[model samples]
Target: MSVLDCGCGPGTITQGIAQIVAPGKVIGCDLEPGMVERAAALAEGANLDNLSFQVGNILDLPFEDNTFDAVLSCAVTEHLGEPVKAMSELGRVVKRGGVVGITRTDWAAHMIAPSCGAVNRFFELFESGFNLQGGTMNGGRNLPSMLGEAGLNVVDVLIALSGAYTPEPGNAMVNGWAEWIENLPLFDRVIEEGLTTRDELDAMCAEMREWGAQPGTIAATGGCRVVARKD
Candidate 1:
């Protein structure tokens, strides 16, 4: 079956999808030009003939209606400036029986205690941007409602829970919080906005690392997998 990867980044996932769907077509699209280029390189490196990467905004997908059999997005929906518009576009492009999936970090669930004062401020500001962009920290929280409103049926709702380990002085929960903040694209932005400082970020991460030394610190990704069928 054909597949579309919305908000695909660096084609790491695109290349994986290409491998999974050998002899079938797989297209990856992203809003960032840098990401599109990176995806193209990865796809080409893998020699994935069925894979293609494009740069396009989700709010206004540059594809015709009923053009895909399935669409998947990861760590992206929450970053969209217009998730509703983006969701509407996702629903509009796929044919009946086609499936759609979205995965994003659950910001609401992210906790960072014992952090540097600056990093704490940054975390708060960064989380706020999820709303500023018209999305949310927990993209899956309202998946059913959002998809239903967009004229799609909730075919399935799968929840995936995962844990990471730092194996040191830090505990899983503590390291998890540190990792989340360090991994955010908004961290720098927030810092620039005077929400926090680099020293704070480093201190927090160091503390987490120290705290995670035993058997490794761990972070659990309590994510939701939503399957929606086009009407």
Candidate 2:
């Protein structure tokens, strides 16, 4: 069946979806033209003839109504200022009886064993900055109801926990996350707003690194996955 991968950043998951629906059309849409270009290039490099990429915003998708057989979006709604509007747009594009799947990370459910105060401070500041930037840090849990509100029937809900167990120093799981934390725009916005200083941020990152270095250090986060159907 045809599918649309909304906010298909970098085409990582979109490529997988294309493979799943081989010979069926799959369109990956993202807001950034660069991302679209990157996705398209990756798809071409992988010889995924069934996949295509386009520039589009979730709030206002470029497709006509009932265009695709199904729609799938991952890790997108949490970043939107108008998440329900975006969901409605997804519903608008899918044909009748089509499925819409969304997966979102729930920051409120994020857990760290032997938690460090510095890490806590970091998340607090980060989440505050995220909200200030018109994003929700822990909106994953509400997506099922949001889908229903957007005129879709909720079919299933799955809560999955992703974790790093005793990760080595500079491993991808913990280190990659730390790196992403270091580069997030939220921290920059937080600094610009005078909410915190860069020095403190550096200290926090250092402490978090030390915490991750400790033996048996574990970090876990939850992802809420929802499946809805268009009536």
Candidate 3:
């Protein structure tokens, strides 16, 4: 069956879906022109003739009503100010009896072993900044309700808790959290708001790295996957 992957960055998921559906087509859509170009190039390199990429807004999809047999999005709704509206659009594009799958992370549910008060404070500041930027840090918890509100029947919900205690420098879970923390502009906002000082932030970062490298330390995050269908 035909599929639509919303915000299909670099066409990774789109190509996978295309392979799964074989003769069926998969369209990868993203709002950024650069991402669309990158996705197109990747699909081309993979020789996925059944896959294509397009630049389009999630709030206003480019297709007509009931255009796709299945629609999927991952890690997208949290960035939206109107996630339910986007869900409505996703639902609107799927034909009757089609499936819609969405997965999102709940940042509030993150767990870190050997937790320090300073690190927790840092995360609090980060959450504040995320809210200030119009993001829903707890969006994953609202998926089922959003899908139901969008007139889709919620069929299944999967909760995946990811954790790692490896000392390896590039461990996906550890490195992912570290990279996200390092790249966050929230620290700047926190400093500007007088919530914390640069020295304190630096200290926290050092502590985080040290804690991550220590034996028996663990870092974990929560993800929610929802599958819904249009009846």
Candidate 4:
């Protein structure tokens, strides 16, 4: 099967799919040339002869109509101002009877244990900061509607929660959040936008770490994946 992975950053997932669809071709597309280069390098390192990478936009995919047997995108829609348009483009690239799959993180559904005013304030600031950056916090919950609107038949929906209960540095969710908080530019942006002060953000980060250490504490975020068929 010929497959296209839209918004495939570094081609991690695209490489995995290439392995699964051995002897079949897979193209990983991203908007950033650097990302394309990184993906291409990884594919070459993996010796994946059937895999390739290209720089392209989701809103206007570079592929011809009905060029792919399947299309897949992950963790991309929330950043898009016109998600439906991108979805339609995904649908357009798939051959009839082919499939399209998308997954998104629902930022609004994220929860931290031992709720308190400080924790609430932290999330409020996070949400506001994301919005100020032109992101949709609730994009995951709207996957089915978006796919349907794009003229695809929704075949399956999967929702899952992921987080860390212990203060394990290797835990992906924990590390991801920590890295985001520690990114100097993002931190500065939040402060510049008046979402919160540096001191308050630091306090919240410390509190979050403390909470992660507590017994039975969990910091979880929801994700949704939708599989659709172009009929």
User: Highest TM-score, which number?
Assistant: 2
Q: Measured by TM-score, how close is model 1 to the native structure? A: 0.81
The CA-based lDDT of model 4 is what? 0.82
Q: What local lDDT score does residue 227 receive in model 4, on the 0 to 100 scale?
A: 97
lDDT of 1 by residue, 46-135 (tens): 778899989988888898999988888887777666666677898888888798877656645543333345334444666765665566
Task: For candidate 2, write residues 1-231 as lDDT tens digits.
Answer: 999999999999999999999999999999999999988887777888888999999999998999999999999998888899999999999999999999987878877778678767866786788789788778888989999999999999998788888745532355555675689877888899998998988787777787777877777877899999999
lDDT of 4 by residue, 1-231 (tens): 999999999999999999999899999999999999998887776888899999999999888999999999998888777889999999999999999999988867876765645556655666676677777656698899999999999999998886766544333454355456767465678899776787887777766565555556667878899999999
For every candidate in turn, the CA RMSD to the true structure comes to 3.6, 1.5, 2.2, 2.3
Overlapping backbone residue pairs in candidate 4 total: 0
- What is the TM-score (0 to 1) of candidate 4? 0.89
Query: Model 2, which residues run further than 4 Å from truth?
Result: 167-171
All candidates: TM-score: 0.81, 0.95, 0.89, 0.89
lDDT of each: 0.73, 0.86, 0.82, 0.82
The residue pairs found clashing in candidate 3 are: none
